[model samples]
Target: MTAVPEEQPAWRQRAVERSTRAAKLRAEQRVQRFLDAAQELIAEKRTTDFTVQEVVDRSKQSLRSFYQHFDGKHELLLALFEDALSKSAAEIRETAGSQSDPLQALRLAVEMLFEQSLSNPGVERPLFSDFALQLLVKHPAQVATAHLPLHQVFTELVEQAEDAGVIPAGKPRRQASILMQTVMFVAQGNGVPAGSHAAAVSAEEVWQFCLGGLSGVPVRN
Candidate 1:
């Protein structure tokens, strides 16, 4: 509890600041290295194809350091997918919440879907395609896995529409499912040529189409 001195030396203060900054920079660099390694490995093959050691080597970091940032491979892959979903959800939440009209909210939600697909190409390739297929096909038990928080956001949007009388009063879950399928189809509709209409279609176009379906004349409510 004794004070070291009335005033610290300038050089010592500078050294302390430099050390703190360096530590922060190192942490940031390590995260980037980890993500870069993940992207490189995922590009080459599926999730099952890569190991912790391979990721560390690709990152040019020690295995111990990799463990410092992540508990294990499962944790890392979950983190990667969750991060992408979180970003997309933020945009969707903002778009959906800010709009007064239910149709606008639906449009924004759809737009968020396409935007997420485009922004995170690396994730879209694995999670939306292969990982999703594997979880549904090879591992039915896995399909019952915890609902991604992002999906909850989508469900909430459906609930809002139902309350607003934009959608049918009953079967909110079914309505949400239909909307989810439409978004998924458009987002995962790859393989089309660049010049084609669907290929050229913007996120806005997807949003408009979805909004039309949700708000069609004969209100189901």
Candidate 2:
């Protein structure tokens, strides 16, 4: 007959559970510290060229600690990219929700995205150009997963607008996706130098164009 293992005493079991929870909390704190450090470096340098050792040094954590949480710099960047997009989505959702009209809400969301790109070019530019672009080329699936939150919010607003007859009766999800892509393309180009061959487009103009496209009405300046 196989022998059965003895169960731990109640007090010992409780102590072990508490210890496990504490360890998990500490691990999470360590990861946050590393992430914060990397984000700070990216903002300060206006680029993603910082090294893993730099992150370790900034976080005041050992290389071993960083490796314990992340495999490499690419993994860390991916984590930061996902976190940033998720937070952006939340902010857009909250801001858009404040408006009673669905069309106005969608417009506000688009304006907010453009404003962020213009106002925070240092951070947003590098993130999209250096990290997001590369991720799109190499790991498209990951990009889609990270972008889902923002896309979902846009889809909800589009659906609301369609139901209200503010927009044409068509594919709300497709419309939302197009709106997102158009806004992103414009926002990404906002960093172009003033003297570049590309003509500068104002945020209001972009919004008007989008509104016209959805309503199937010509927008008059």
Best by TM-score: 2
> What Cα-based lDDT does every candidate model obtain?
0.67, 0.83
Q: What lDDT tens digits, residue by residue, belong to model 1 across residues 141-181?
A: 53434225557677788778778887666565666667766
Candidate 2, lDDT over the whole model: 0.83
Clashing pairs in 1: none
List, in order, the clash count of every candidate structure: 0, 0
Q: Give each prediction's root-mean-square deviation over alpha carbons.
A: 8.0, 3.1
Quote model 2's TM-score: 0.85
> Per-prediction TM-score, please?
0.59, 0.85
Using lDDT as the measure, the top candidate is 2
User: What tens digits encode model 2's per-residue C-alpha lDDT throughout 1-221?
Assistant: 99999999999999999999999999999999999898889878877889999999999999999999998988898888888778888999999999999989999988876665553525643134556678788778877888889889989998899999888888877888898778877776765776654667788888998999888999996
Clashes of 2: 0
lDDT of 1 at 91: 66
Clashing pairs in 2: none
